[model samples]
Target chain A: MTGIFFDAVTLSFGKRKIFDNVTLKFDCRKIFGVTGANGSGKSTLLKLAGKILHPDSGTVNFPDNAQIAALSPEMKIYDALTAVENLKFFARLRGKILSDEKIFELGRRTGLDMKTFGNERTENFSTGMRQRLKFAILLAVDADIWLLDEPTANLDDTGRENFFAEIQAAKSEKIILLATNDVAEAQICDEIIRLPM
Target chain B: MKLFGSRCDCVLAIVRKDFLLNLRRRATFAAMMMFALTTVASLSLSTGGAILDEKFLAAILWVVIFFAATAGLSGTFDDEAQAGTLSTLKLYGDAQAILFGKMFVSMLSLLALTIFILPIFCVLFDVNVEKIFLLLATILFGLIGLAAAGTLTAALTTSAKIKGGLFAILLFPVTLPIFLPAIRLTEISFTSAQVDSSLLVVIGAFDTILILASSILYDYL
Candidate 1:
């Protein structure tokens, strides 16, 4: 009841069946790795859990008041807004007003120095910087469920260390789903759900 | 009461973010302003000192407003989609709040355009407005209707391959109800100085229906 449940979930894209009669329950407070090859429904599974996509049949259930946040490569930050502004705007959307100090703390947790680059518009940011900002946004929302697809794709070595540390720190009370193909990343998960190609 | 408060916060946040983006980009507002100014100036020059009839003038005014609204407002959702932020909004923001916030921004843009163009239109065309209050009311209602219709059309077409073209095509047909009544009301204001209560009611009703429909349809999209 407190975590995500998929009951007889069958989802298809046109004629190709992505999830065929799949039933899985994610009810733990540890990080779960959804590992699969390219085009193997890794991201699709996370999206289904996030309710961004609906199953063609069956049901995916989570608590009614559970807050969910997703970070995918397809997601983007506002180009014209500064990094701090972006974090504040996203937090506000979820009815939370984030102070500058809180935003700075989130930034620091993601290996980003708010005092240095917080005021610059994100359009000028590099790929790694944008990825770090996305992580900061993920932290700012402070959701109960986190659906992170390819979470470390564009992060540098330092950024990855910071990300893993944060994940390890927050794994006690949150259900974190990490969809990745990297063996090292998958090793960090307590349970690995491998999707068949 | 708590739900209502949260909804208001979401709406306000969306409006604030959009306004800031528009201010920074300056593309949509600039395009709308340029389209309105160019059309009005061209019509004024082409008239060649001839005293245009009130009905024709009213028609011209509405035509300018209509096309300008189309040119600028159709990108409301297209911009978000193109920038890859539409999904983010869908994930975090409430459906009704997003619809209302975008509609409110469109309304503000149209109101600003009307203020900028009305005096120039009146002076260049040498048209004496008999009822200023009625004219403003008619314009206000017409713009609200336009904003509502445009916002819905933008949302409906955000996923289209040719979003801008589809937006214009769909908007014209969908907004006919608002345009016809609005044009008539403007003419009444200009010529007879008599208000058509029924026409105002029609436009208001259209606005309400469009806003409600958009709020419902947005979640599915």
Candidate 2:
């Protein structure tokens, strides 16, 4: 009741049935790795938990007051906004007022040189920089649930390390459903749920 | 305890973000202004020094505003969809906040376009607006109606394959209520200089209903 639960969930895209009568429950204070093949609905499962997608039948339920944050290839920050501005704007959306120092700290944790690029618009950022900006947003919102789909796709080695460390530090208090194919990433999860069972 | 966030703050944040993005890109505002100017200039030249009827001119004014709005404001949600920021907004933003925020931005853009074009239209056509205040009120209510309709259309068509075409198709019929009353009000402003309070009420009521309906329906979309 205090976590995410899927009850006999069935979802299909057109004629292809991706999920059929699947039930799973994820408790808090744990990092759950959702692993599967390319078409195995790893990301789809995370989307369901994040409430970005609804199952055609059955139900996906979570706490009423839970705040959800998602980082996926399909999620992007405003290209015209500066990194700091993006953080501030998103925080405001979640009713959180972030200070300049706190924002810079999030930037630092994500291995972004926010002091140098904070004022610069994100359209000029490189791919890895944009990914870091997304991570910064993920941290800024401070959500109860994090649905990360391929969270390390564009990060460099150091960026990946910082991401893991952040996830490890926050794992004790949040319900994080990480969808990834990386063996190393999956190994860190408290439990790994393989898709297409 | 407010778990998610304050709805009012979320709406304000969305409005601020959209305005900032528009300011930086200058796409929507610029497109609206360009279309308005081009249409007015074309009308001025095509008239060939002939005196146009006030009622016809009133129709032309609303037509120009309507099309320019269609061209510019139809992409309100498409911008988020294309940029892939829609999911994030859905994750953190309240549904009513998103709708109102977008509607506010659309109204502001239309207001700016009107302010920029009206002077030029009046000068080029050599038309003296006898009841300027009434004309302004009509434009204001008409714009609110247009913005409400346009924002809802954008949200509805954001997922369509042929978004532009569908948006125009749907927006035209949906906004006819606003346009009919707006055209009549404009004509009265120019000729009789009398308040057609009934038409004003119609446009105002339509705007309110559309906005309230959009707020309830946006969450589903």
DockQ of every predicted complex: 0.85, 0.88
What would the per-residue lDDT of candidate 2 be over residues A52-165, giving only the tens digit for each residue? 889999999998888898888888888999999998998898888999899889989999998899999999999899999999999999988989888898899999999999
> Model 1 over residues B3-96: C-alpha lDDT tens digits?
8898888888888999899899998998988999999999999989798887889889989998898888988988898899989887878888
What TM-score would you give candidate 1 relative to the actual structure? 0.97
Candidate 2 similarity to native, TM-score: 0.97
* B57-156 per-residue lDDT for model 2 (tens digits): 8898989898888888888999889888887787778788889889998999899889999989888887778888889999999999889989999999
The 10 consecutive residues of candidate 1 chain B with the worst lDDT sum are B159-168
Native contact share for candidate 2: 0.89
